[model samples]
Target: MHLYFLMIFFAALPAWFLSTLEGWITVDCTRAAVSSPMECTVGERFAFSSRNTRYATWKARSASLHRHDRRGSSVSYQLVLSTASGEVPVLRSSTGSDKIERIARDLNAAIGAGSTRFSAEAPPDSLFWFASFLVFLFAGVGALIALVGKRSGKS
Candidate 1:
């Protein structure tokens, strides 16, 4: 039974990763020339506003793109804005590194700042690695339990 459950869990991982690609955020700089800051709006592609829609504004001079390395050659990118409080992520993506990099370059050009790429190494305890460890741990324990149970039944 546990083996069957493990199979199901493994099959669901791809579906979960794909589901994350559904939403997008748009950064608008048209108003920047009028002394207005750039704005990032989420859920614009869906043409409907829900509670999940997010609105953020920041001066272009203070924002840049950040790329974070993930497990298995995967990369996560985000548009980060530095403010008095701290850096805030206005947009994010786990795929499409080229497209995201292009957008970041264009935005940086508009801001009059050179486009910069910041790559952060993945932490040892990243979610993906941790989850993978847990899965293997459980599988090993389950296999041991089953093996013991079978041996005892044969006695």
Candidate 2:
């Protein structure tokens, strides 16, 4: 009896781990300040004009949030942009947690953001398919084990 359970558990172990593959969680960016959500990826060059500049360019990287003080609830976000010399903080905005999160999400979606301390890298469709295949394979193996166990008992 114990042997049967062990066989089943081992067969399903890979599937169990693969099943944890999660999809991208959608966020509400309705309140974001961007004129429109533009698709972006890391290291991509984007052009935007501020009042003082006519032709300004920036390389998209990622955004991060920070707190003003330990006792303060005020939150701010800074867009870490890459320039010819090095990375620099090009933009900063003070907002609440929810709005800050939305801004981060917008930057990520626009620039194909990478994994950060607070968020994860988006999983590809192939990963989900591979995980599904493993699940089916384990199910078949478990069924075969059940059949063999039954036959041996009958004999």
Candidate 3:
């Protein structure tokens, strides 16, 4: 019935969210000159100290997302680290066209959060998950209503 279909649809939403969660972008922290390796997320700023004598410490001010298309056949996503001094080439990864675009868009928004100019906003993970949970909860409510209706002999 419609309620059953709704339940299935709602159940799949969280799975979809989980599958798309940061799997598209593969960050390579190995090339970094840092003393200790570190992992980074999209909406965060990371800082680390270099192993080299010079350029002791560095902070990643923002992330620049790029999409390069080669020969109109291949495409790649590159995440460049922006520091106080200049830009540094960092992570290079591949993903689906749609997913890469979404990641780039979100990265830009996170980088532009504090600027005075207008910027697009990406929804926080907490808010997105909460909303997904509500939909799942409502699907259960719908199933209960359907059961009640069936028991009461009303179509």
Residues 50-119, model 2: lDDT tens digits: 1111111123344545556668754333434444556654332221223334534554564343322122
lDDT of 3 at 129: 53
Candidate 3 lDDT by residue in tens digits, 1-155: 96686566665665455334323222222213333222233332111111111111122323334445664554333334444556554432223234434544444453344322222222323433554566668678768777787788864
Question: Order of all candidates by TM-score, from best down to worst?
Answer: 1, 2, 3
Report clash pairs, candidate 2: 40-110, 40-111, 41-111
Candidates' C-alpha lDDT:
0.43, 0.41, 0.40
> For each predicted model, how many residue pairs clash, with residues at least 3 apart or on different chains?
0, 3, 0
The list of candidate 1 runs beyond 4 A from truth reads: 1-14, 22-25, 32-34, 42-72, 83-85, 113-155
**Model 3 CA deviation exceeding 4 Å by range:** 6-28, 32-59, 63-124
State which candidate has the highest lDDT: 1
The superposed Cα distance between candidate 3 and the true structure at residue 155, in angstroms, equals: 11
What is the C-alpha lDDT profile of model 1 across 18-124, one tens digit per residue? 33442344444433343444444332221122213333334322232345555445455555554345556554334333344555555656545421222111121
Alpha-carbon deviation at 144 in model 1, angstroms: 36
Model 2 residue 84 CA deviation (Å) reads 24
